[model samples]
Target: MEFETKYITPDIKLALFEGKLFKTEVMFEHHMLVWFISGETKIIQADATHIFGAGDIFLIPRNQLATIINYPRDGKPHKTVAMHLTKERLKEFYTRHTAVGKLQPLQKVYRFSKHPLLESCLASLIPYFDLGDDLPPDLAAIKIEEAISILRSIDKAMDGLLADFEEPGKIDLTDFMERHYMFNMTLDRFGYLTGRSLATFRRDFKKTFNTTPQKWLTEKRLELAHYQIAEKKRKPTDVYFEVGFENLSHFSYAFKSHFGYPPNALFKDRD
Candidate 1:
């Protein structure tokens, strides 16, 4: 199956939030690294709650339930820069190294070690987040690659220190699907990609992502469609084809179900 990878420009996504902020439970479809550049927020994961503050970095693996509770003090909101990575791009860094595979979910809530090299690497990520709107696409990608390399190095070192670290199999599957959802594929094909049987993929996929493959694919398509409509100013027909949906009717139904309204609802003023 052929796959088309999408890159989100840094300027379009990089944001700082503050004040009393609360977000509903959401599932992240890509690997994310969040650094609390300042202030504090309460992060709730499936089994634990963490109080995050200055210099604290947190990793949220793909397709997991999470909530962020932000309480600002003195009218100042918490600040953060969250970096999102597509799985296919991240796979490029892990290809030749065994240790790369061992660093799947690095969810630490404390300060990183005082090693100068690691500190410098973490400092470099700030510029990636600081990319201006007019920055060239190639240059932005190069910056992202540099940041990923530094992060991978830190992850490798941390994984070596912690022997009990284990990759979450469900998260692995979710990341794979997010990266390849545009392909014309079947359950058997997905299983083959992951070196598993169709039956096993079905069983574990639901166990990990809390949904079936079809449901997940439908959601992924809708998300891409929404991004195109809202960000790229693309029409519904164009989004349907671009996101690999074969029929407008199917796309409309899924879009409505996912976003609680019809696609036209998003562009009624123009209509």
Candidate 2:
């Protein structure tokens, strides 16, 4: 049995998942503050992977790519409370201060392990879960403001990470795509994160990769799938989702279409 539930307001919520495992690739639109209440999480980034167990607090900066694996541990479901620092709220908080922050290269996710203030701030929200989606706007805003204050008090960098409101600037398309192609998001979403409009993303993608994004993605995903299935001796089922195919059947269909044979054919001694 696998199910996930969220008791959420517009900016905050409790997430509960009960299953063997749950995986997702995300590029958040808002800077997210999260505290793990139970279970464990593996956050996979381009350069590093992080593990968060119960009582860990962390922040995922806006517009970063990550694949998160949630595991149910110690016979308990995976549970967490997540708060999003929205642009509107930040603007309100930092009103009359007009400053653009200079970014250091490639700022990664920030971790605050078991900080008492952050833990207290989030734990108060568990009871609010009974309100479910109807968590009140006024109360939610107050709680969010308190969290912002707590963050500012703890780290000077929180101001720059959360309050510097700027759209993503243009980045090197080739490198970005290579590292992030396995994430299954729409073309526009990919374009946004790489700081391009849809039209410009297509134009730049074509010039840099020398092929359409769709074709390139399909080929790259299939190639990775082929390497895993044939050389690494992994099953087709296990290889499929990791390479960005949504499900087994579609991966199988596309695999056969690309190689002129089914993926399972690469394996010997099939009973």
User: In terms of TM-score, which candidate is strongest?
Assistant: 2
TM-score of each: 0.47, 0.83
lDDT of 2 by residue, 15-57 (tens): 8888888888888888899999899998877667799999999
Which pairs clash (backbone N, Cα, C closer than 3 Å) in model 2?
none
Clashes of each: 2, 0
TM-score for candidate 1, please give it.
0.47
Residue 182 error for model 2, in Å? 1.0
**Predicted structure with the largest lDDT when compared to the true one:** 2
Off by over 4 Å in 2: 1-8, 96-106, 131-137, 227-236, 259-271
